[model samples]
Target: MRVLSCIVGQHNLWLVLLAAVVCVAGSWVALRLLLRATDRHGVQRSGWLFLAAVAAGSSVWCTHFIAMLAYDATAPVTFEPILTMQSLLIAIAGMGAGFWLALYNRLPPEIGGAIAGLSVAAMHYTGMAAYHVDGVIAWNMNYVVASVVLSVVIISAAVGATIRGTSRNSLLIGLGAFVGGIVSLHFTGMTAVSVTPFVTGAPIADATVFATMAVAVAGVALMVVGTGVASHLIDSEVTHENIAALRHLAMTDSLTDLPNRTGFNEYLHFELQRAEQGGRSLALIGIDLDKFKEINDLRGHEAGDEALKTIGRRLLNLSRGGEFVARIGGDEFAALKRFRNDDDLREFIQRLEEALFKPLTIEDLEITCGASLGIAIYPQDGRDAERLIGNADLAMYRAKADLTRTVCYYEPQMDEKSRERRGLAMDLRSAIEHKELELKYQVQKSVESGEVRGYEVLLRWKHPERGYIPPSEFIPIAEESGSILAIGEWVMREAAREALAWPLPHKIAVNVSPVQLMHVDLARSIHEILLETGLPPRRLEIEITESTIIADKVRSLDALRRIRALGVTVAIDDFGTGYSSLDTLRSFPFDKIKLDSSFMKEIETSQQARAIIRAVLALGKSLDIKVLAEGVETGMQLEILRSEGCHEVQGFLLGAPETFVADVVAVEERRIA
Candidate 1:
């Protein structure tokens, strides 16, 4: 009855309310800091945990001291300075220990909360012990026990709720419970106290000093809590910004700053679904830049990167309205378009071509790039993302294969062709392993003597089901599928071995594909083949087209130089058809030049063809390189070549390509006879 009367009649209501406010504010800040601490690791987590301990200890200490000021003990009371400071240290240490215990995963988080709640009780009792009066102080044991039990239960619930989840509701519940615990503990502990006035001999502190201490404690608590909240807000903003930047980097291409393949794939699926829902048509255009590899080979990768950046900028500038563009590969790009009709699609394709084909200036050198574009319309070419992308790729390859076409719409036939090519490529690999490939020899003869000089080796494939497959049909498949390397090696070995059987030691020429010329160790392979076949290196000749040399001049010339150093001759086959034939001739020490067959077909009727042939032969003579006229089918062609002092000729007039080694040997014997 006495305790109830003291609480109802002897407390300053305004100061009690002020203490409650401080308790709630400090509890909120401490919970926020604790949650942040749990999210971190190592020393950073320890630092946050220390801040949380400081906030929590300050809150409980200030709440107790302020509540003490609110209580009217009916006597002059002053806080003992040394004991009060000791109580504050006890609060900080106890809270720190509880938080450190809570961080262990081996124990339940609620266990840590229970420990923390006990620390609050310990702090309150210690703080109450620091209170001094010019009177005797007594505590009701039952009320004291009730205060400790109720405060611990409430604080434990608060910690458990706050640590379990990060939702706003959880935080609010934890904050409210924490405030209730401190308020309950302070007021209930105050109710346990009963003071009896006595005469004092020494001067004691008055209400003024207690009031000043309460105000100072409240101010410091508020300042600490405010600083914690401010730091949390700043760190949250920085973390959000960092997450957004990382997301942008993941989706964007570093070289071009355009959407990458991953981003394009995601957007494509989204747009496809949107188009399906709206009952509208969308076009997926696949773009591949032609001669891009050549640019990378001739110029540096830096120049290649600059070219891509310029192209990306052009595409980005032109991407307006319901259009999206992305860089999907090294030199491949894709675009999405929502179009109403055929005319709209055509206009968009034209604009895209114009933008992409515009000359890109890299390192003060203007380079014009060509592009092959393919369009796959939604619902027509495909209904889903993967099918649309695949159809677009098929159409793009078709556009690339046909020299005259720059743009193509998706056609069902292209898919069939693609499947057939893939099947043929697989079969070609099997053929190489099974040794199903054979070589034929076309005779190279002296233009004036009408005498056979040597045989130029030709590859022939006789598929079991398809009968005789032409070189024009399967050679490209081999090159595109990367099976040319194996086939080229086989051809060199077989040609060198077969040439050894020739009754005469005539030079045997073997054609090397551009794919093999650039990828294989040509000189080393030749030397190994010569040693294996016991064929003289001087009798082996390697024939490569200007296209091979133009692909990567440095590597190609180096490989050719190494072959020549090994006493193996190199010839430039199909000269005058490439971009820079004279440059190719000047760049390498070629032993012979084979005039392209297209010139021979026109040499008799067209004056331009004659002049070109005359000029090439004259150039070869001046360079002291033997000139070989290919496709010499008629006497007129032979007579014309002989007049021009052509060193060699190979065509029907001399002999047709023979598959049998006996046939070539018999021809050589007949010529001698």
Candidate 2:
């Protein structure tokens, strides 16, 4: 009614209302079209821009509409109110634009479009103000100059933002944008509406409107760029964090947090190259954790993985960062070190030996395991990676043979020995299938009575092609290949059968590998073998190395107690060869202890060996346990053992392990005879 009345009554209110609505609707439509164009072109679309426009306009619209609901109040019309409200409206709109523009501050580079749009909008608002407030002091020559200045400022900001601004660099460009905006706003104000007062020619207000406008522009520019810088910095940091994650994955094991095989290989190759080029001595040591499979099988794989990682961390911590160490395979690790001299290398090796011997606690249980280390030195032992690793691995096997924290440098003769050993291992597995594997009995004599006692049944492998392959030679091979489980099962069965055949009051001893000990159902297996072979469980003794019990001690002890409960004898075989001493021996319940052959072979030549043997025998006497010495080849060893009150002796002098069941019969026949 007012619009109709305006044209007829010569009133301007109708025209103003129509124009205001058109401008508002037109602005909204323009933004929508712009967003659509960006989407169609596949250019980067600004959803934030759309959100911003909606927020500012919607706020203004609601305020206007709510105000209109008051009696007789409709939307304001005519220059009087439109001009009054224009500055405040633009100021609020500029704030909305700035808020959204600042959202990208954490990005590495500020986008050019945001800077350009904000710069232009600042000038545009000033222009709109001038248009609304006519005859303001700015309506002078400054109008043209302000427009040029504003255009240039916006162009500069566009260029700077387009080039991209990193978190660090955005600040400089943002500063430039601020200065430019201020200059443009000031000039635009100077040329806009006059400050002339109600009196036609009175100069506008106390301070020139242009000057005040310039200050406001300066403050607004400052706010916009400040937010941009903050956003850019955030993105930079996020990108850096992503890179760090990738590097961690590449260099470390996911499970163990130690260096992985890739890392190990890199270090090995690097050290090998450096050692070769520098002519400095470098040693590569390969360590294989003994009977690791048993631990996994018994405790479950999770516990096993924990054990491996724990061991790896211990080795890594023990090593100086200068020495490269990594887990190269499951239950196997490789280390490379460059040393000053042979002694220096040996010292390092000794340190590693000590480090490995420390008790490893996993899942709140103290577990023991012995590692065999093979050393391959640069120049002397190998010239390259393949040869060095191969030789070191073979040497480790030889060291494993000794069942000590044994470290061996590769030797040419070791190659032949290793090949022969591997060949024997392969044949030994076949031997079990071919029925060439047999158990023999050796007489156990009482030192006091000089009378026969219980016999020890030892498994003997006589390869058809390689006659009488020694237990020392083939035993480790089988153990390493995991064929030992089968060999072990066979050994238990055969030994039990042989013992059942013996007539006199005698028990039979059968050595079990650490692998067999780890059998989760070992107790059940033992019971089955005893039942099948007609041997009383009480009469069978199972001999195991100190290394077997030493590795993962708590678990081993638990297994030992369970085996003992089944009435099977538990003896620590190769008693003194492992890292454990008599102090740790207290933890075990040993019915008998077998003196290792190293002490046996040197009994006559070595006074220390004799002393060790005598001390062990004395220890057995004190503990009320039986002591026996195997591989007592000479009368000197026998006489020494007899003198020391050793309970039994098994060796060539007494009798070697034989394949013939008749030999056991003959021995028992002799005792019965």
Candidate 3:
């Protein structure tokens, strides 16, 4: 009751309000600094903590002095300079220690708050001790104790609230508690003072001096607090901007500036959930660019990248309401959409196909790009993102396999085939390891004399339960599954080793897959195999199709050159089928050209086939390269090939592909005989 009477009656209302304002402003700044400090580490955290301490200490000091100026003590008073400075120092150091304990040491907030509260009480009493008056002063011990206890409790609560979190409620509670603590402590402590004037002495200072001091303190306090507030606001803005930029980078493809696989997965998941709720169908369309690798190999990756950017921009433009597009992989993209009926879906797909199929100009070269699209519908195709994406991938591969189709919808049969392929892939790995694969040798002979020249090596796989799996069936799977690399190496090594056992030095021709030729160092592997098998390089011939050479012309030519340098012959097999047969011949110094069997199948019926054969034979002869006619099964074909001056012929008419090494050796012996 006494403290309230003294506060209400003796204090100037306006000055009291000013003191409260300063306290709250300073507390707000300190709280922000502390929160920022918590987010930082090491020296940066310490810097923020030091700034918080200064703001908090200056606030308490200014509030104490202002409230003292508002109090009517009826006697002139001044502050002792050294003691006043000491009080301010005590507050700053004490607060800093408290912050360090809570933040750096990872102590509880309450403990730090208690220490801060104690510092507040200590600062108040020390400032009181700095008070000088030309009068006799008496203190009420009870009021002093009550003032200390109340201030400690209130200020502790303030620190606890502010340090707890950066939430609005917490800040408000902390600000209120801080103002209340400063106000209550000053007024309550004032109630403890009783001043008796001396009879003859004049006062040392007047009210104007104290007013000036109060103004100075308030100015300094406001300036310090304002600086802290401004720094925090700027830092917060920068932090938010950095976070947004990092998020964008995480979800975006750097090259195309499109949503990448991570972003696609998130978008798909969200769409699936929304579709479930809205009871609407969503389609996840998977698009894989056909022959994209060829583009990379031929035009260089820069042109390929430019092509992708053009495609991404087109797809982005095509996307409208309920449509989302993303580039999910290299040469792969996806689109998400919501549709009502089949007609709407088909119309959208048509637009997507048209947009993708359009020609793109990259690096001043006009190129036609095509995409194979696979769609998996919601609810029916899959219930989740992973399953849906997988189904769409299977459909995309299916469309890719059938050149006649560019768009395919997910079907159950596709899943069965995928599972079968995966099982076969696993089995193929085991087959290689267990030596379950066999090689067959087919005889190639001179068309003029029917003299044996060399034999072509062929790969054959016989499954344990399924009996024989033809090359046509499993070769594509091997290429797709990337097992072709291992298979190619195994076949090369086995053929070279078997040829080393030959009674005659007939050339052994082994076919190489493009995957193996481009992906691995084929020349080095061949050199190693020859050395390991002790077979002469002249007896080894590597047969590659024109398709392989065209896949990566530069690399393919370089590898071929290296093989030829090592004295191993290089042949372009199935030559007439590829679009670039003449170009391939000009690109590399091939030892032989194997006429595609397709031309042989049509030779008897088609005049065009015979003409093409004749042209290729003339071209090969003009270039001083031998031409071998493969699949020559009849006398008519042989006679025609001979009349055309074909250098070699291989067919079932000369001999069937022999599985046993002894049979091949016996045939060679018979031919010699």
Off by over 4 Å in 1: 1-14, 74-77, 105-108, 133-136, 166-170, 196-220, 276-279, 339-344, 432-435, 500-503, 514-521, 549-555, 579-583, 601-615, 631-645, 652-655
Alpha carbon deviation, residue 398, candidate 2 (Å): 6.5
- Candidate 3: list runs displaced more than 4 Å: 13-18, 75-97, 106-115, 126-135, 149-161, 164-180, 197-226, 430-439, 448-452, 479-506, 514-538, 546-567, 576-588, 598-619, 631-645, 651-673
Deviation (Å) of 218 in candidate 3: 6.0
Q: What TM-score does each of the candidates earn? A: 0.88, 0.57, 0.84
Tell me the whole-model lDDT of each prediction, alpha carbons only. Answer: 0.86, 0.63, 0.86
Poorest 10 consecutive residues of model 2 by lDDT? 69-78
Q: Model 3, range 339-406, lDDT digits (tens) per residue?
A: 99989889889999998899988776676789899999998999999899999999998998898999
Which of the two, 1 or 2, has more lDDT?
A: 1
> How big is the RMSD of model 2?
12.6
Determine the backbone clash count of candidate 2: 28
Q: What TM-score number comes out for model 1?
A: 0.88
Model 1 worst lDDT window (10 residues): 200-209
